[model samples]
Target: MLTLIGGGRDRTGGRGQTAAAAIHALLREEILSLRRKPGEPIAEKDIAAAHGVSRTPVREALLRLADEGLVDIIAKSGTHVSRIPLADLPEAITIRRVLEQLAVRGAVASATGSQIIELRAILVRTAEAAEAGDTEAFHRADEAFHEAVATAGRHPGVWALVRHVKLQVDRFRRLTLPLEGRMARVVAEHEAVLAAIEARDAEAAAAAMGAHVDGLSLGLDDLKRFNPGYFLEDSARSDLKRA
Candidate 1:
């Protein structure tokens, strides 16, 4: 079931989840912005005050983030931002690339004309969002554009798989997000992918998708430098110990 991880079950849990989701959004934003810093202890009382929620909700929210592998919880030391493993980024990106290309091809093969039109409209909106420098809106449009493609494929499992691994790549993506001129390039890439889709060229669409992912892989130097040690074997072993 899609129960909130530790946000209880009924009343208390339900209320806590209301707070949990709010807290989760704020914490995720802070983490992605690097404002919270990795390995920093999660001070519950502080977060509670900042979020204006009871400690109960904050605790539940932390548990949910832990479940998502976004936070590390130690028995006595409490919780901290989960250190992202950079070395695995390429592999993670590789997996996403494969799935996305498959999704693109499937989407083209299965898409009705109306679906294609809808997707094309989203891409146009995405380009506008990027050009306007609305990062959040752009991200939303980007996500919608991809989800539409995946949906057109009629493969729900692709969404599940993409969601699972995308969290791992989120941090690096956040870092590169503000890079100057990045959005324009992304918009161009989207245009190329859209062109292929419009032409019903599955092979061309797949190639464009491959290049899109490869760009991320090639530009992830900051991710690698941000946390070299965490990418090591010992780090995985340590994380396993925590579990």
Candidate 2:
């Protein structure tokens, strides 16, 4: 029973939404941090009890995670976290590169001075978070930074696609965290990307985006080796008997 600070139910709606969001964050963090063993059955009752919530919110959160491909929902047995499929990496990386490049170029053109400052703040904080080995903080700062860039661009389509790729890429990225110095390296890459964006160098930003996603793809094999059980071959996941 681990408790996260500033975490848990938000009761404003009185619909157990805070509990749902808290449970969702916890589960996703578990998956992302490999705290929840891959292919593990994610029983709704356990989660609800853990968060002191009802079945409804717990189920709702599971459904949302399902949409993000994080969990497989079943009729009788229960929800189970999805196993990472190695073969899908190439497609995911390709999609990310295309979408993020657009995001960077568009953001560079539309960014305000304040928006660049916000992006820079996120980058610096992300570096600190990574150094501290605070995976949760690092992940939040990383996503927020990207969202900032997309928002700066005012390209809703690119933002939507970037969101899609992120959901798909997230599970695998979790697997990458244990590689020594990897998180710091990722932060450094982000610094370079943001610098390009701030300099109004659209071409550099686009190129940096390509390099960033590709570097992540390259890091996967090393990560897969470190936690071989955390990833799956599509053929091996027929039923997730083991992950």
Candidate 3:
């Protein structure tokens, strides 16, 4: 079961609004991080009680989540964390590849010396988190590294668009985070992109970025083999065929 617990506010400051936002952020993180499994039931009553809020706030939060496709709110039935839409993976990957590769190319052309150093710092932190087996820390650093690159490239807006579709991909990535040496490989891949960018080689940087981002092919087989229950039925079969 998922629980929401945090700073409570007084009624005067639109307590319900604050509570709803708080619940929404907590639930969103849980869904994205796979702590709240896909298709898992999310009881408004339970969450309300856990957070000492009324069902009204919980409902508001859930509706907001539904807008983001993070949850599905059925009319009569209860709400559930949205399942990974495996069929959408290919399209999502394509979008991410194009936009992120462009972002890297832009970074190579426009990034400052200070920005390059900041990216290296993020990579170092990522490596340290991976070495320590801190999955959450590694994930945060990974996201930061990409965001830094996008910012360095002067394409922060593009990064926003990338994030819109990356949520689905992220759930899948979280599932594969436990594979042996996966984090280390991720670190290596980041290093490759950083190296190309640091050397001011736009072509190499784009190629490296493309390879790193599109390398989802290698993990598809493992995901189906190891965690078959996580994917949609038809999509799972399709993924297996591709694998």
Which candidate gets the maximum TM-score versus the true structure?
3
lDDT, candidate 3, 123-153, per-residue tens: 9999999999999999999999999999999
Cand. 2 Cα-lDDT: 0.75
Candidate 2 vs 3: which has more TM-score = 3
What digit string (tens of lDDT, one per residue) describes model 2 on residues 1-243?
324312455633445557667666667667756677677878767666655667877787777777666777765556677777677778888888888888889888999999999999999899899989988888889888878888888876776776666654777786676578879888888988998987899999998888988887767767767768766667343452221
Candidate number with the higher lDDT (1 or 2): 2
Residue 71, model 2, lDDT: 77
Deviating ranges (above 4 Å) for candidate 1: 1-37, 49-57, 222-243
Model 3 — which ten-residue stretch has the worst lDDT? 234-243
Q: Of models 2 and 3, which has the larger lDDT?
A: 3
Candidate 2 positional error at 134, Å: 2.4
- Residue 233 shift from truth in candidate 3, angstroms: 3.5
